[model samples]
Target: MATQTLALTRLAASAWGCSVRRAKELYTKVIRSVLAYGASAWHKVADTKKGPALSLTTVQNSCLRTVTGAYKATPQCYLETEAAVPPLDLYLSARAASFEIPTETTGKLQLLRGACIKAAEIINRERSARRRRQRRPQGATSETPVTLWPSDAQLASAKQWLGGQTVEKALKEKWEQRWFHAVTPTRGRRELAAESPPDCGACHRYDDMLKHEASVLMQACTGRIGLRSFLFTCRVPDVPTPLCNCGEGRETAEHLILYCKDFKESREHLATQLAPNSLRTRRDLAALTTKKDTARLIVKWLLRTGRLPLYKRAMEVGGPPEHVNLFRP
Candidate 1:
C-alpha cells in the first residue's frame, strides 16, 4: 500500500513537477500517513525489530530521493535533512506516544498505554539532558558532544526514543559532519547553513517561479545535475570522460557556471543582469545563488546556456510574464 502511494507521488515530486516544499508536503500528508497507519498499535514491535522498520524506511528513502531530485548515492541522512523529514522510527514513535486513550479504557488498550508511557519517559529523559547541556556556561566543556546514537545501540529503538526536534538536530549534525568529510569533488565544495532548514530560500522567495526552474537550481546546487562530471562519477556508460566539450576542465557546476568558455556569453549576460555583483570566482557564484533575485537570474543564465537538456522547455518558454525584464538590473 505504501509502495503504491509512493509510485503516484513520484510524478509530482519529480524534477520538473513541483517545488521541494510542495513535494515534501505531499509525502508527509499522503504517503507517510499511509505508512504509519495503525502505528500506535505496532510501533513498539517495529522499533525493536529491523524487518518492518527497514521496509518502511526503504519506501521513505525512495520518496525523499524523488522529492529532492538527489542522486541515488546521496546518504539517507542527507536526504532526510534536505526534505526536512524526521527519521521514520522517530516519526512513528512520536505518533504512537502522542496517542491518547480514555482513562476508563481497559483490556487491549493496556499494551498501547504501556508503550506510550515508555516512549514518553525516554523522550523526557533525553530532553532533560539536552536542556542541561544548553544551560552550561559557554566553553564550560571543551569535550566534543556526542550527537549520534551509540554504535551498539538498537537503531530504531534509540531513534524512536528521541524527541522529534532532537532527532532532527542530530541528523543535521550528522549531515554537516559527512558533508565536511565527503570525498566526492562536487559534494565537498557544497556548504550547508548552520541554522537554516535545508530547503532552498531562493525557491521559497520566488513564489511564482516555474517548477522546472526550481528543480534545475536545486540540482545545480547539490551537484547532482546532468553535468558530465557528475555523470562520470556515477559511472554512466555513455559519458566517456568528465571533461567539458571545451576541454579546459571537468564539466562540474562550478566549472560551467564560473570558468567554462562554452558559457562565456551566458556568463557575461548574467554579469550584466546582476550589475555591481560580478561572478569572478566560485565564492561569488555561490553568493549570487543565495539571494532571491540573483538566484532567478542564475537560473535564467543556466537555461540560456542550453546545457541542461532536462530543463530545455524552461529555456524556450522563458520565465513568468513579470520576469521578462529579469535581466535588467
Candidate 2:
C-alpha cells in the first residue's frame, strides 16, 4: 500500500508540475491518510517497536524530499522542519489517540480505545525521558524523571494528548538547536535558518511563484545550488576552491544574492524594486524572500546574475516575458 502511495506522491510533488505548498497539502490529505488508515488498531506496536514505523517514515521522508526539492543528503530533521510536517511516529500516536468511542462501545472497539490511550501515555513518557537525558549535563548524576503526561483528570479531557501543534513546536525547537550548533559544512543554511522563521518563510509563499522559480529559490535558500562553495563542500573535482570569480569571497548563495561585485548593475535594479531599504545583509534577504512580491524580485535578480546555470533554461522558460528588460536602462 505504501509503495503504491509513494508513486502517486512523487508524481504530485514532481519538480515540473507542483509547488512546494501544494505537494505538502497533497501529502497531508492523501498520502498520509492512506498510510495511517488503520493506525488505531496497530499504533501501539508501531510506536513501541521501530520496525513497524520504518515503512511509514520512509514514505514520508521521500515525500518531504520531493516537496522541498532538497538534496538527497539533506538531514531528515531539516526536511521535516522545512516541510512543517511532524515526525511519523508522533503523528501516528496522535491519530490513534484521537479516535472517539461511545460510552456504550464494548468488546474489541472499547479495548482498542483503551489500548490507544495507553500507547499515547507510554510514548509520551519515553519521549520525555529521552529529552531529559539529552538535556542532562555530561557526567552529571541522573535526576528522578518527572511525569510528562497530564493528570488523570486532565487526560480525560485531552483527546489529542500528543497534539499536532505541540509536536510541531517541539520539532521546530529541536531543528533550531541543531541549526544553531551545526558545523561549518552547513554555514550557509545555518545562517539562513537563523534569520528565517521556524517553518521557513519562503516555503509558505511558494504558491505565488512559478514552479521553476520556486524550485530555484528553494535550492538557493537551502545552500544546495550549483555555487562554488556548495560544490567545494560536495568535493566536486572541478571546484578546487570555494572562491568567487570576482576574487572577493566564497561563491555562496548569500554572496551571489547580496554581495557579488559582478552583479552590481543588477543589484542596483533590484534595490530600486526593493525600495526604501537596501539589501545588505542576511536579514534583509530573509525579509525579502518571505513576501510574495519581494520574493519574485529575488528570483528575477538570481536569473539576471546567471549564477545558477543548471536552472537557467527552466527559469527563462517560466520567467516573466519582460524578464530580458529587467536591467535595461
Candidate 3:
C-alpha cells in the first residue's frame, strides 16, 4: 500500500492543470494504475510471502523492464513516474540495440534498477566529457559542427510541426530522426512541433474544452457534410501556429475557432453544418453546453471517436489539443 501510495504521490504532482473536483476524478484512475501494477507484482511475489514486506529497492528493480510494456499500454500512468525516475536508459538501449534481455517473470524491479544504474553511469560519463571539452583552451577550434537539416523523415516531422502534412511516409521519417537525435543546448526550429494525433499544445485547463469542440464539429458534420466524412478517411493537413499567447496575446483555440475573424468562414461553415438552426443565436458553440451533461456528452464524442469531420478539421486548423483521437491510422 505504501509503495503504491508513493507512486501516486509522484504521479499526481506531474498531472498538471487538474481541478480539485477533476483531480478527485483523476485520482481513481491513478490509484487504479498504481495498485494494478503493485497488485500484479505482489501476486507474482506472493508465494515468497514477501508481497507487502519488500524493500523499495526490491520493488523498483522488479518493476523497471515490465514498466516499458506497461507504459506502452497505460501512458498516463507512466508519466506519473517521469520526474522522479532516471531516464529509462536500459529501455532506450534495448530499442537501440534491438535485443531482448531475459527478465524474471517473477518481477522486473531488479532489471529496472540495473537499467537505472547504467543510465546514471552513462550520464556521469557524458557530463565528464562535457566538462573536459569546456576546460579546453578557448582558442582551440572545436570539431566542425554538424548543420544537418531534416532528413526525409525529419522533414515530414518538420512539416507536421509546421501544421502542413501527415503522410505516413512523412511521419515515419520524422520519428526516425526524433528517435535518435542528441539533445543540444540550442533549441531546434521544430521544437514546438505538435499536430493532432501526436502533439497537443493547449493549457491543461482547456484540454477538455477543446475536446468538446472537436466532438461538436464531428457530430454536426458527419451526416450533413462531405468534408467531415472525408476527413474521417484521411489525415487532415495540420497548421502549426507556434506563437504563444501568454503575454496579453490571443491566439488560442477559442480565439482561433470562435472569436477570430480570420476563421469566420470556416467556423460559420461548421456551425451551419452541425446546428444550422442554432447557428443564428449561437455565437459560440463552446458556450452552448454550460450544462454539465451536455458538455460531458460532447467531450466524450469528440475525444473518444474519429467518425466526425469536426474532430479532424479542428485537428488540422488547431494543433492537437489534449482530447486524443485513438482511431487515427
Candidate 4:
C-alpha cells in the first residue's frame, strides 16, 4: 500500500505540470518512455518472492494513468502557491521484470487517465467562477471603466508655475533673444512662413509691422493706451488727410504713416530742430510712440518708430509749405 500510494503521488506531480487541455497530447510522448523502461523494473520487483503479485504490464498501465491524469487536471501554472509535492518511496522503488499483462488493459488505462484529467479540470474552473463573484469590490458598477487621476503633486506643480510672477517677463525676454525679426522658413524653400498671419490695418498696408509692434506694447500697458495713440506717436494720423499733389481724395492711415507728402516735410523740419545730442543717437527718441502723443508729437514719435519713407519722399519733392502738422516749432 505504501508503494502504491507513492506511485500515485509521482503520477500526480507529472500531471500537474501540464494543462488539462493538453494532457493527452503530452501523455502519448511520456507514456512511450515509461513503458520502455518502467515495465522491466516493475517486472523484476513483482517476480520477487516477497513482492506483490501484480503483472508487469498492469503496473505500467496504472502508473501511466495516474501520472498523466494528475498533471493534466491541475496544470503547474495554477498550482505554484499550493505546497504539495510527490512521494519519494514509490518513485524510488524497483519494479518486477518477470510479470506480464494483457495489451487490452494498457489501452484502457490511457483512456481512463484522459477522462479523469478532464473531470479535475471542470472542478477547478467551477471553483474559480465562484471565487470571482465573491471577491468583487463594492460600489464598482459593471458599466464604469477603470480610470486613473493625476496625483496631488502634479496639480500642485501646475498651480505653482501659473502663479509665478516672472512668466510674462520671461516670455518677452525669450522672444527678444531670437535672430530674425519675423520671417520663418517654409517647406522645401527658404521662404517667409507667417509666424503671424498678415492683417489688414487701418492704414490699408499689406505689411503692418508697426501696428503689430504697437499692439504688443499696448497689451503690456493694460489698456491704458490704444492703437490710435500708438499711430499718432508714429505720426501716421488719427484722422485721414487728402493727398498733397492731387485733390483726388482723402489720404488713408498708410498715407499719413508712410505715404503722406506733408507728413514727411513736418518730420524733416522736426529732425533739424532737434538738439545736437538728440540728433546723433538712436536712444534719444526711443520711448515716444504713436500712443505717446498723436496730434502734437507725431514727428518725435515717428523718429522713434523708424518710419522714414514718407520723410525721404517729402525731402526729394517739396511738399506744401502750410502742411506742417508733424513738427512743432
| Top candidate when judged by TM-score against the true structure | 2
Sequence-dependent TM-score of model 4: 0.20
User: Per-residue lDDT of 127-216 in model 4, one digit per residue for the tens?
Assistant: 667658788686655432223322334223323422443433322332322212323343212111112122112112101222222222
lDDT of 3 by residue, 153-257 (tens): 422323334243333333333433443343222521111111112221112222343333422322231111122222333334542332322322233333333
Stretches > 4 Å off in candidate 4: 1-141, 145-148, 151-170, 173-260, 263-265, 272-296, 299-329
lDDT of 1 by residue, 110-133 (tens): 564577667767777777688687
Please give the lDDT score for candidate 4. Answer: 0.31
**How many angstroms is residue 14 displaced in model 1 relative to the true structure, after the best TM-score fit?**
4.0
Candidate 3 lDDT for residue 254: 32
Candidate 2 lDDT, 247-305, residue by residue in tens: 99999778987888998888888898889866888878877776778877887788667
| Per-residue error (Å), model 3, residue 56 | 20
Q: What lDDT would each prediction earn against the true structure?
A: 0.62, 0.64, 0.33, 0.31
State the TM-score for model 1: 0.63
Tell me the spans in candidate 1 whose CA falls farther than 4 Å from its real position.
Answer: 2-15, 44-51, 96-187, 190-207, 275-278, 317-329
Q: What are the clash counts of all predictions, listed in order?
A: 0, 0, 16, 25
Predicted structure 2: lDDT: 0.64
Runs with alpha carbons beyond 4 Å of true place in candidate 3: 1-26, 29-249, 276-286, 289-329
True-structure RMSD, every candidate? 15.3, 13.1, 22.3, 40.4
